[model samples]
Target: MHSDRHEPAPLRVELAGARLAGPAPVPTGVTASRPAAAVPHPTPTQPLSPARLDTPSTWPRRTLLRLVGASAVGLPVVAALAACAEDDTVHPPDPLAAQEVLARADAAAATAAIALAPGSHAALSTIATERTAHADALRTEIDRVIGVYGDGTTPVHRTGALTVPGPGGSPVPASEVETASAQPSTLDGVRDQLVRSQQSAAALARTESGYRAGLLASISAACATQAGVLLT
Candidate 1:
C-alpha cells in the first residue's frame, strides 16, 4: 500500500549573473500572489553652486542692506569706545602743578618785598632763595613721575612748563603782588602770601604719601618759619 503524505519541494537559489532554469513552482495548497510593484527611488539633490558662494547679488536685498547698515553703525561706535579707552589711560593733571605755582608766586612776592622795603632786604632775599629752591624741587619730582621712554625722550605730558606764568599771563609784577587790603608796607603783603602758601602745602601734604608728602611738609614748615618768625 502507497503512503498519502507528500514530500516538500526543495528551495532553488539562482547564482549571481546567471539566469534561472525556469519559474519557481508554487507549493501545493498555497495560492499564488502577483509580484509587488517596484518602488521608485527619490532623485538625489545637486550640491550648491561654487560660483554663487561669494556672489552678493544672490543674497536677499533686505539682508544685504541690514548687514551694510550694521557695519556702518558699528564701526563708529567701536572707534568711539577705543577713543574713550585711550582717554582713560592718559595721566591726570599733576597735583604738584598748583604747588609749584604757589612756590614761584611766593618767591616773586619775596623779591618784590625787598624792593618795596629796603630794611628787610636780608630776610626777603633768604625767603626768595628758599622759595625758588622749593619750586625747583617740585619740578624735579613732577618730571620723575612722568618718566622717560626707551629712546630717552620724555613722555608727552601737560605738566611741562618752562616758566610758571602768574595771573594775567605774566610774571607776578610788584604792582599785582599787593594784597586786597591796603597794607602799611610790602612786608605785610609778603607775609600774607607766605601764610597762604604754607596752608596750601600743609593741606596737600595730608593727602599725599611717600617722598611727596615729606617734601610738601618740609616746604610748609619752611614757609611758616618765614612768615611767622623771619617776616615778623
Candidate 2:
C-alpha cells in the first residue's frame, strides 16, 4: 500500500568563512536546482496587402494620345455632313422660264384683230381686249418670277430665252419684233391662228403647277372661248 501524503521539503544551511555548503533537497512539485527553460512564443499572422493600380498596363500613354488624334481628325468630316444637311434645305429650281414665248403670240393677236376681225366696234374690241389681258397677265407673271414689282426697275438674273417654234417647225425669236412683223390675214385665218395659239397656251399650262399654273389655265380657257366667238 502506497501512502497518499506528499513528502516534506528539506532544509538548507550555509557555513561561514571557510567553505560553501552543499545544495539542499528540493520540495515536492517545486523545481529549485535547475533553471526553467524559455517559454515558446506564438507567431502573429501577417495581414494581406492591397493590389497596386497600374495605369500604363490598363491604358498606355501612347494609346490615349492616339485616341485624341483620331477624335480631332473626325471633326471636319462631321462639320461637312452638317453643311450638306443645311444646303439640302435650300429652295427648288423654277419651272416657268419656257412660257416667255406667250408674250409674242399675245402681241400678234392684238395686232391681227384690228385688221382682220369683221366688225367696226364690239367684235374687234373683244378680240383686242382678250389679247391685251393675256399680255398683261404674262408681264405680271414675268415680274413675279424675276422678283420685280411696279414697273420692274431692277431685274434679277434673267430667265433663259424660250425656244419658240414656228409653223414650219423652225425656231423663232420670242420678241415684240417677231409679233410686229406678222402679216395681216383674213378673219378665218386670224381665227385659226388665235385658236392654235390658245391650244399652245393650254399645253403650256399642263406643264406648270400651283397659282401660276391656275392663272395660265384660266387664260387659255378665256382665249379659246374668245376665239370660238370670232368663228360664230
Candidate 3:
C-alpha cells in the first residue's frame, strides 16, 4: 500500500542568498542580490608609474643620487688641479750655467790628479797644474762678470755614471774610473774621457768671446795634449 503523506520537494536556489518573490522584510544592509565581483590587488613585482614617484620620500632618494652623480663627474677635475699645483712647485735645474760646467771640469781633473802617485807620471802633474790654472782663470772671470764666486764643488757621482745624456760621459773621480773600467789599468779610460771632455769644451767655446773663449780653447788644447801623453 502507498504512504498516506507525500515526501517534501527539495528547496531550489540560484545563489546562496537567493530569495522568493514574497514581500518578506529584507535585512537593513544585506540583500538577496549577488555581491559585486572582486577587484584585483596590485602585485609587488609590478613597476610604479612616473606619477607614483611624486612622494616626498622618493624625491629625497632621487636628490641623493643626483648629488652622487655630480661628485663622480667633479672628482677627476679636482684631482687634475691638485696635480698641476704640485707640478708648479717643482722646477727643472738650469742647464746653461757656465760656472757649473767649468766647476765640474775642475773637480774631475783634480780628482784624477790627486790619485796619481808622486813622480809616477810627470804628465799627470802637468795636467793637474793646468787644471788648477783653469780653475783660477774661471774664478777670476766669474768675479769680473757675476761678481760672486760660485759653489766651487762637484756633485759626487757613481762610477761610469751617465749623469748627463750626451756622447761624452761626465768626468768622475779616478777611483770611480778604476771602478768603472773593465780592465785593471784605467789609463785608456782616462784618455778616452779627456778626449771627450776637450771636444765638448771646444763646442762650448764657440759660444764665448774675448778672454773666456781664449781660455776655453787653451784648456781644450791642453786636455788633448794630456790625452796624447797618456798614449805614449
Give the poorly placed runs of model 3, Cα more than 4 Å off.
1-120, 148-185
Each model's lDDT: 0.74, 0.58, 0.55
Tell me how many clashing residue pairs each candidate has.
0, 0, 0
lDDT of each residue in 1-232, candidate 2, tens digit only = 2443432222122333214554555679986767689898987866643333344465576688888899799987777556545543333323333343553454455566567554633664666666667667676776676564245454334344455545544555556435543666555655665666676667777877887778778777876876687546
What's the best-to-worst order under lDDT? 1, 2, 3
Ranking 2 against 3 by TM-score, winner: 2
Winner of 1 and 2 under TM-score: 1
Instruction: Please provide, for model 3 over 108-181, each residue's C-alpha lDDT reduced to its tens digit, 9 standing for 90 to 100.
Output: 54355445443335665555566567657765665455332134533221122233323245544334433343
What is the lDDT for 164 in model 2?
Answer: 58
Q: What TM-score does each of the candidates earn?
A: 0.51, 0.48, 0.39
Stretches of candidate 2 above 4 Å error? 1-110, 116-121, 149-152, 168-171, 180-182
10 residues in a row with least lDDT, candidate 1: 8-17
Which one wins by TM-score: 1 or 3?
1
lDDT of 3 at 25: 61
TM-score of 3: 0.39
For candidate 1, the lDDT comes to 0.74
